[model samples]
Target: MTCKRALTAYPELLSRTVAAPSWVMPGTVRDNAIFLSGEVDEVGLCFFETAACLAYGENDLPEHLADLPLGWHVHLPGDLPWCDGGAEAAVPALRLMDKVAFLGAHRAVLHPPVGFADGAARLVAFVRAWEAAGRNPEDLCLENIRGEDLTGLWRTLCDLGCKVCLDMGHVLSYGQYGLLSLPGLSGRTSMLHANAPGPGGRHLSLDTLDGAGCGVGRAMCALLPDDAVVMVEVFDWEGVRRSLPLLETWFAAQR
Candidate 1:
């Protein structure tokens, strides 16, 4: 189903803009951004590969990226050097942030490093570096990833004033239900990465979610603030096409 059709069916979804990932098509971020802008409420610029994104160069991006009607946000790279005090990684991330400053992206999703002896301190250093770069701490949303529910860094997250980007696929696949109980989670969350886990660690369409999984997703969505974004988080256009109607159906059930 089309995004327009889903929104028409459940108009309340307008409050929380549903977004499509930037890699929906096998093309450059610029190409996918331009294509999906007409299909969804926003485009999630997937800067998952830091080296590739930086290699693509800022000037190569669409000149009118910020001028597009669809809103945008950056998904910071997954392989940041957070294990090493995060200073090295911060430079590239902030550079990417600067590159997309024209989009006026209010949110940027980050996957905090796990299994590090000083993970919390590293996270703090990362946030400090972000602030040191003149970026808003609240704009950085630490996502809940596999092997980490984010509970370990709860105090640090609160102390640093960073936000949360809850991922439903991770919650369901890894049984990260504890994320629901994080102190003040409802108030702190600014974005939701909605998807179902596929085989081999890939993201699947939300329609692949079962009854219990949908319950978890609903619970998470209930906690999101009114303006929080819900990105389909799938990499293919077909996945998004299938998920949009299901998401609208979920919204309908909530009402």
Candidate 2:
């Protein structure tokens, strides 16, 4: 559905894809997003928030938005092993997801470390950690990314038994992005990231999408079932504002 309309749904669905690069942790960014999105459901966050949560060793999410109905998008922390050289951190990461799931949150948009394949090997470590903490496999969402060396990221996901969060812009980063397909997908996947492009794939703010990088969006929509979450991962408010029409068109096609 359209971003605007997704917000209008039952229990209230909001957008704002939180991301975590290797330099930062995912939970720290998530806490910031929660604090921000608490103001307006769609809070923008970086990928480091998860690590922040783990490092803090808090059993629950930051209580910033606890009073308000909560919705969270948690990017997985770290790269490679996901917890760096420390396997101890896995317990906390999975613990964090379980706590969020307990909140009955709208959904946690997981940016699966696009390591290699979205399959079993890469995901196995994370999956075991999550399950050990009592998290349902379905509660997590593995995400996709742009770039060539995405080894077994997807394969690890399948083995882990989790769904995906498809970022539209990352897929469209290349012309051949259209060639990729969303295979073996169920309606369980949700959330997205995109931005307006001025031309030459410039990642404009979220408020403006002139249909610059839209091919992957089409590919994702075709791959997914109806009623999935679409987080327009726009650069800023302006880009998000402009991309609405494009999302509307995409959502309309689903009908």
RMSD of each: 2.4, 6.5
Say which candidate scores most in lDDT.
1
lDDT values, one for every candidate: 0.83, 0.48
Count of backbone clashes, every candidate in sequence: 0, 53
lDDT (Cα) of model 2? 0.48
Model 2, span 1-255: residue lDDT tens: 223332333222233332222112134433544434422344423334555554543433455544544344555554434434223445556555555553455344454444344334435666676677666677676655544312345555666677666665555554435325435654546555555434665556544433444544655656654455555554444445455556555555654
lDDT of 1 at 84: 58
**Among all windows of ten consecutive residues in candidate 2, which has the lowest summed lDDT?**
17-26
- Scanning candidate 1 in windows of ten residues, the lowest lDDT window is 1-10
Model 1, 116-213: lDDT tens digits are 88888788778888888888999999999987899998888989999999999999889999889977999999999989998988999988988898
Q: 93, model 1: CA deviation in Å? A: 0.8
After superposition, candidate 1 runs with Cα above 4 Å error: 1-6, 58-60
